[model samples]
Target: MLSVSGDVSASTNFTLAQIQALPANTQTVSFGSGTGQQTHVYTGASVWTLLNQVGIATNPAVKNDVLGKYVVATGSDNYRAVFPMGELSPDFGNRGNQVVYAETLNGTSAALTSTDGPLRVTAPGDIKGGRYVSNLAKLEVHTATSTATATGGGVTTQFQLSGAIAHPATYDLAALQALPAVTRTIGANTYTGVSLWDLINASGIQTSATVKNDLLGFYLVATGSDGYRTVISLGELSPDFGNQPDIVAYSMNGAPLPGTGFARLVIPNDGKAGGYVSNLVALEVVSAPR
Candidate 1:
């Protein structure tokens, strides 16, 4: 049994069950948003918990480190949300209260619309509606690191960029157009008029020494106030002048961009698509070149 809380708007509020029927570990659910208030329901259990129940040597060490991961809840409306790993873990129990399946909501049997219902996710402490997807469609658990072993071998030496953006009054398009040219492009878009380096350099975030020590690879994962996500690989961050393009976010008609309530990644090199990074959140320097 897990407790969940969320609000759809100023007038609508929700506090419901976080898991559903099936079995302890064999259930699955989907979540997304729709018209009116966003709803969260449960569908079935998941293999994740089944592995846990069977005592299959689940990633005990890493399981204890859920704070570094993210949970994606999807709904039938195609709406989705993301919850940090920290919110799902239990404080006093062997594991965090994170349950992938449930049976009811608000003391009632959980139900959903043909298009949206029958399943959902309830991350009790998550405040973002985007994190509480309704329609109840999918439950995906991703490990952010490649070397993330269930035991102590999962740790990696990497550079972590943690910081905030000032949510500019307006993106200086003219200023961006005036900057010098960049040396590379990553995807297929061209940000020919802006100086991305200047933006990163000016951001007050602390850049760990690891960023400069090794040019292994970079990754960027961006999330919206809604549960939308986008991933940018190392090359996409720093594109080569041809087909690859650098990532440049634009506000609606240049209105000040909303503050990234959550931090997104920004890598300068490596060619790869960028969108909805499920597991790997940001850039990591796996190893330096010899």
Candidate 2:
């Protein structure tokens, strides 16, 4: 049994038990004025406990870093909010301190017709009402990966990309044509050229012996020295005129490539761009195992 007490700017208030009765994994936290109040005191259960109760398992390998993730809570009304992962973990020591789902209010349950009632997300205690997500209908946990890539015939763990390279901030036609190729490797995987593979592979997707040959995709958002971004796809990785794509780096250059840093992925392929893709800050990969 769970209990909560707080003032909301709504015509009514809700309680934990009332929330639990609406959906198995659904929980709500309410705040704001008009239909609700602007004050922030959410009643609901901890997100961690709810996840465990719902049997949605987190990967054991990355459990320690789970606090760095985020939860995207959405409502039936299409309203949404993002909560940082750290707020819901053991860092707070209160099992019920994480995001909460509210169903009842003001000692009375909300009727089905009430738009403000039925469900909402109560943010962690430390967060203010501006952070609390009211009228939440769906909660999704999103793990942030620096990069994603295919490996062992499947996608491997995502990783962060960062490095220094000798090149101008932007490339003109002559600069793009004259730039030297860069090479890098991670674990047994090596990449030569300019494909976003390194970014994809860095995205923290683990692969086991049983799973391989998976097609992988990554969103390579390269920010220039001046804050310009260029997005490239896997197909665009092949070299131009030659077998390799112009934008990718390749071993054909006949030199040893740099080793990928700790928890990093090596990008392979070729690119005609002159600017070296150093200082990579973010990577994301989504894939299915073969």
Candidate 3:
């Protein structure tokens, strides 16, 4: 059995047969003699699918925390390697590159050699077999401390974004305004800034078929400077879905505003101002608890 840990809702153990039961992918790789001619087909499960089974955020739009995330694949011999989650994330532009937990080598009925596997990683596009971990014993998902940095454009960004994404980006007033403009009239105020959806995309979370399929589990939770938080669904950010005209407000009434949270968040869809986050310290994409 293989142990999976870190950033998961619950630790899990899986047998070789169980791993094979998940969705599988196939690839051909050649390593012997370093001539790239001795090729063999590798087939196993998608790492993303495995993460999803353990409830590790898997939405394309939700994005992971800005802190960063990586997966550590270790072998029974103690050899290991780390890969950024984004490389395996479909939304991060590496769409077809799949890092799979391989069970079968060469043919459907042919299992991996005892020296190489009952399981191993079939690293996508990796020419070096160094990434092809054998006798897989554990897979640990790791996350880094989210770092928020303001652009030189006179913006001081402190808040972070996390969820099913790879990178979290911070923006200041000038930086926020630098994004595509979406001006709208809210309660007693005409706000101009980027749409909340655009801001989320700027943080590296994007819409893909996978994201659309998993929208029900996705939400945005904004933390205000006052320590208050409000959650919004991914569908709510779309016009066809909820038609919410939410935005990260930079200028109120079309005039330069001097304030603590220069780039504030406004929820025009909410009847009450309870969802209005003033001085948002953090804007995160989260997956609803399974």
Q: What value of lDDT does candidate 2 attain over all alpha carbons?
A: 0.35
Across 137-225, the per-residue lDDT of candidate 2 in tens digits comes to 55655543333232322221222333221121332223322545455553454545443432233333343335221121212334322
Could you tell me the lDDT of residue 133 within candidate 3? 67
Error of 3 at 198 (Å): 32
Which residue runs of candidate 1 sit more than 4 Å off their true CA positions? 1-68, 92-110, 146-290
Top candidate (TM-score)? 3
Native-referenced Cα lDDT, model 3? 0.61
Arranged by TM-score with the best first, the candidates are 3, 2, 1
Once model 1 is optimally superposed onto the true structure by TM-score, how far is the C-alpha of residue 38 displaced, in angstroms?
A: 8.7
Lowest-lDDT window of 10 residues in candidate 2?
A: 3-12
Report how far off residue 225 is in candidate 2 (Å): 21
What TM-score, to 2 decimals, does candidate 2 have? 0.36
lDDT of each: 0.32, 0.35, 0.61
Per-residue CA lDDT of model 3 for 1-290, tens digit only, reads 88988888798998877887887777766543345435667777777777768876433453244214556677797666554454455543132333344444434547777887777765544434555667888877765332222232333245555666777666776667667899888668788878998667556654346432344335576665654445565544644333457887877887864563676777664445555656667777754432
User: Which numbered prediction scores highest in lDDT against the true structure?
Assistant: 3
Q: What TM value does model 1 have?
A: 0.32
Number of clashes recorded per candidate: 54, 70, 10
Give a tens-digit lDDT track for model 1, residues 1-290: 22121211112112223244334432222323344333444445442342233222224443233333443444555444443332232331111223333445666654454443444444332222333344555443443333222222222222233323322212333544344534333364332323433444344323245442111123233333232333222222222211123334332123422343122222223223233222222222221111
Sequence-dependent TM-score of model 3: 0.47
